[model samples]
Target: MKIRCSTFLNCHLLLFRLYFLSLLVFTFATTPEEDPSVIVSRFQKYLQINTAQPHPNYYEAADFILSQANSLSLHSQTLEFVEGKPTLLLKWPGSNPNLPSILLNSHTDVVPSEPHKWAHPPFDAHLDPNGDIYARGSQDMKCVGMQYLEAIRRLKASGFQPIRTVYLSFVPDEEIGGHDGAEKFADSDIFNKMNVGIVVDEGLASPNENYRVFYAERCPWWLVIKATGAPGHGAKLYDNTAMENLLKSIESVRRFRAAQFDLVKAGLKAEGEVTSVNMVFLKAGTPSPTGFVMNLQPSEAEAGFDIRVPPTADQESLEKRIAEEWAPASRNMTFTFKQKVSVHDKFGKPILTAADSSNPWWTLLEGAVKKANGKLGKPEIFPASTDARYFRKRGLPAIGFSPMANTPILLHDHNEFLNQAEYLKGIDMYESIIKAYASYVEHTRDGASREEL
Candidate 1:
């Protein structure tokens, strides 16, 4: 797989661990002692740890989370399939262990940040009197990760024990995709043993007051197209040169890209409804020792794209499109994949979960939202990719929800932040969601489909 440098959700890992680890000691100074039980304080404290990837502070975060689990008397364990990349699981056992469990999942890693671009240091978790807590993961997700624990904290304090065991999973490296994190775990015996009935993972923040819940997401497809030709002097005009071939391929891809964007621009399709492609990066041409352009032409060139295809699209058709139009073999251009999401589960059925009556879990989730006195926007496929797809790949049903209302989508952007009132409100929101989903008294009927479970 090509290592593409990314911003946050879109980041390809670049800059080795040393660059990030060097910032650790400076970023790790503890936040002043505050009432750990206080929701904001806990959020701030959790945000203080620099769990930004390519080298996240997973151990420290796990230690803190395990301690919190202990305080609530919830059973907890840390699993490390790839040593150093920890998956922290906290369980509030249900009244009946025989039933399937509910999972509340959040990633512990955030994208790297350039400190100069932020009003507050990315790792500072700075909270002003205005209620905006400026930090890297504050909005992208450390907020939701801590909210899961705080919600459980309140539930425990209120003497509430859910009937179905509820688990909060703090996974690593989600920013780069959950391959080493949720992906490995979801396919493991430990995950299978849990018998996950439903899953709720991070979603986008809403600029509008109505909260958004994602039933599906546009699938991720990362591709690198390479072209080769004879090297020659820049002054020599050669037909079928490497750069020329690459530009042709890129233009074809860009034209297709423009067509998709045009659909959204014309209001004929939502951004999530069509395949979106951005030229992530390009490489070609020789570097000059001290000038702007090199005097020699390079023999090869490559271009990478971050492509997202909506769930309803045909995977085979897309592959054909790439083969025939984008990087045609006829042009001496060949493409390799970093990721191309499979369209179906092992059963060969389409990989979409209904948030409507088609799935029983939908009913339960909607009821929980209504009971919480929160308005849920119409269910839609998430425009971007997320870790939820990992669980979905295992024939599991997962919902992507962030519970961040009236907030701009600042995730992965400079000065990413969330409001204090909004943060606390999310705790309340999760408390209700957890109570409703976990406290179900009725048992799922035998042989129920993954959606029904």
Candidate 2:
């Protein structure tokens, strides 16, 4: 009696698969939503903690976040490079262990803000009569950090474990280019072992009622141009002097700037367009006893340009123009160029969420935003670099998103704030986004045929 054991094994496999599917469906059936007031309070608490950049109060802010994670019974860790600068990381487990992961990331450090310059003290976290929260990091990012914590807390409280693990990363130095912060963290094994599939980072406010999600950002390259020419007397007529070459370079750069400015003003490119080049710093000659000497013919002159180029712009073309047009005269003068020091030695690769990529995360995000009582506005990619660039370079689909409606942008400026209505609404908005993403992954994740795992 050679009974076929293969038949019995096949039957067992079928039962196991059916049971697993049933469990997944059951998990998806019960996902809890967060409260709006609770969300606002959490945000206020975060804003009260002063985490200013350069000398960020990491201990105070990281402690507050860790305490909330502890209340949720999440195993959170505080990672610090220097003694006072700290970063917080929280992890929530999932049902299907083999599934990919998601990361909710925000920076703790805010740029230094003057209290007198603002309507309310930058660290006061004051809620105005109209319910507007006035603070430094209020709109720039503390809102996102608070929203992430609130959503995760409510989700965990409702006994809703995700299908894919969720990791919350709170970093420092994002305002200063993230060298001691996001860039360093990205290089660590912690993120590598997590195998993140998606990342959500901070972005700008929505001038309209709907939120904006950024899929791509232009790389920022700071170039310093040094020109040296003949050191002739002030009375002598100098043709190819340092000042002459420097002025020529500035004029050439100005021409490019004017073109970009016109393109931006005409609305040729969408929001977050890469069309601006700001000359942030300039230096020339030696400082006189009273002030800068005007009549002296300085031997050497240097200037710095903050250049933001779109991914479509060819670097070689621009470099050639600068070298040829701005190059110093030979025999009498010399030219030198250098890149400004940044946290990441090299610029991150420009990323784009392919229109035909396997994951239609953007489409799903749009639907989620609409469901949250906001109309689906246009999805514009960011034109400046961000921490989102770090995750995208690692092959994770990263989106720079923020939920602040009808608000003027004051990022990196004085008097930053967020209205109470917008802040609370943001909580509702993120809830919809997270729920929609989770449900989609749970139900239709299998619909997309499994690729080479």
Candidate 3:
């Protein structure tokens, strides 16, 4: 009787052990903890969401981001300064709340993608055998947004706590200009309450092994020039015809554009250092059933130009030139500017962040990248505008950075993609960066902190 009782207990014990072992195997096979695959999976999931502009599903994206925050035990909230456009914020509170916080900002909305032009469906987030994840926001920004959250997850799992709070902001409408998104938020009481010190925003990808950083960005100026004059037969040569006046203005603009392009082509200046003007549209003549009237010259003609000006450029001089040479009113031409971003802060200071050691934040950032085994290229002005300008205009230090080395600049381009390896490496890079920034407690002279400087 004793032997039978012992045998029954031993058999049940063996059966329980087998069941536990199988459970462990299944867990490992299905869910990985702190694995690169898991990180990539999260990134791909975000890329799958269609947040392309003109009609972005902001609520869905907000819900997805909030879910991630909940998984990480982060404090999350959504604020819509403009109805239907939601801005998401996640916070990892630090031990010391008095210290100024670090803000990592990324936009949810991406430029529209041409689905038929892509090798894979732009919203599919397809990962090929070579480990390239192709999608609409693969490079432009969604990658950065996911990287920020994943880095925080790893930090939390490792029992790491920061001295200063770190905030992740996923705002909308950046691709179409942040008027309803960051622009409003930056000026809101909520942003002021965050006590943000330094903001890190989006930057273009690098074509080489060194990552590119932007200290400033070129401001965009969308210009439309209209000319009105006497209408006449197409064959008749008139002194002040609308088309002729518009053509003269175009020639002036072309000359200026060529000069800027030549400087860049000759390597005398970086593309962002000089003014860039491109003719985007030209409208003239009277439309008919099939085409414009060929025999009669229309009295009015208009041309639109997309112009980018560097902060260091003379804005007043450029405007004067526009009024005189490019679209002189004496020539029956009038011009208007739209979406002209200011190149200076409210205090009249240039919208630029110091990249050298004079700024302690820059020093910390440089050291952090080095610790991650990454190299930074010489800081340059961003060739295009980004949401960073909004923060910079408020006299805050903003850095434009995207950790994508040895990759093509494919933002808003067809077949856009980011290799899984690079994407994983970026997460690692952000982990180090967040740690350095959050742990820093240095204070500068004049009672200002390292971030305030």
Candidate 4:
């Protein structure tokens, strides 16, 4: 026998209520206990602050950085080239003021998060029973910034003084582009005055035991290809309609993307070694109050793509290929570049920090990591861009390292977290690296101390 309609409706309503109740429980059930470690408490406090894009609370974040700097007895300054965007700089001056300084940089702003998708409030900085502290910026880099300061605090407490100056830079607008953050700071007189020699920025975590490092990053190219042709009625088949040419160009670009992906799948290329092209959006058709006009064909259509090219690829050659194939003039197609490439110097060499033995910075960084009981994997070009590129372009050796091993890579993902123990361990590793770099003796003369030489 079939159930009555009223009974079926009542049952469905009951099921819906139960599902919602369970969801609420799952989202807010885990309440974390208070952490005793000063560093852990500070990390939690930082995650509670909102510095995400579009409208980050820059002043409040700067206050936090300033407090940490003052407590550690480090001199600090907050600089803003573009009105509200502030980049905080903290300095620990060494005995030798003339020596090139060490810069440890981290972006303050984080990406947006969806609270409904999280196990805890994304901004609460909740530490669960298992020691995982959940928050939005737990890994995308507030964690590293805190580690840098805490490491210095501990070192100074133990009566250690560096031979060279060390600077901690907390910047903004990295999620969009560094136009307002690092890009401006890198070009500023304050940065040049520091005479930066070696730099360290955030890197991705390693799921395995080995840590990941980056010496280069893929270049991002945002393009829009527009096609123009004769406009006519929808009934007749035209020789070269706007949509037809646009589709042809899209297909051509897709084929190139497929070939690049094939190389990755065949193990001949890593994901960072190949080009990635993806369609972001398309614009066409005339709009009526209800919808697009179906009876008439439009004269213009355009498609947008976000492409990333590896440094190994020749930039000039790729531009020529795009002009020849993707948006050829013979096909009545033209393209616009939303962003351009300029990661090279007057000498025509790509702006990449050498990871080999020839570079003294690289050798020193490798030694520091090993001394911390960390194993670093072979350096790879960062699959995405970072502010480190700005320093490398300025001829300074900037290494991308996060010191997070045996952890999952969860940047910008829902339920992002960092293990409390792991967070503390990162401070220790940073301590080793900072001490090594600050007291480094590149080539001291006989009987000459690091500071004297």
lDDT of every model, 2 decimals = 0.84, 0.73, 0.90, 0.86
Model 2 C-alpha lDDT per residue in residues 48-163, reported as the tens digit of each score: 88888667778888889888888888778888764566778898776665666667899998888777778778988888887878888998798988887776665665666677
Tell me the number of clashing residue pairs for each predicted model.
4, 0, 0, 0
TM-scores vs. true structure, each candidate: 0.88, 0.85, 0.91, 0.88
Give the alpha carbon lDDT tens digit for every residue of 176-244 in model 4.
Answer: 988899999999999989878788998988898888998888888999999999999989899788999
- Model 4 is weakest, by summed lDDT over 10 consecutive residues, at 444-453
The local lDDT score (0 to 100) that residue 280 gets in candidate 3 is 98
Ordered list by lDDT, greatest first: 3, 4, 1, 2
Per residue, candidate 1 scores C-alpha lDDT tens digits across 243-341 of 898999899989999999999999998778899999999998777667536668888899999998887888899899889888888778889999888
Model 2 segments more than 4 A misplaced: 1-38, 81-83, 328-350, 355-358, 440-453
Runs in model 3 deviating more than 4 A are: 1-33, 444-446, 449-453
Candidate achieving the largest TM-score: 3
lDDT of 4 at 123: 92
State, as a TM-score between 0 and 1, how close model 1 is to the true structure. Answer: 0.88
The Cα RMSD in angstroms, rounded to one decimal, for candidate 2 relative to the true structure is 9.0
- Which window of ten consecutive residues has the lowest lDDT sum in model 3? 444-453
Q: List the residue pairs that clash in candidate 3.
A: none
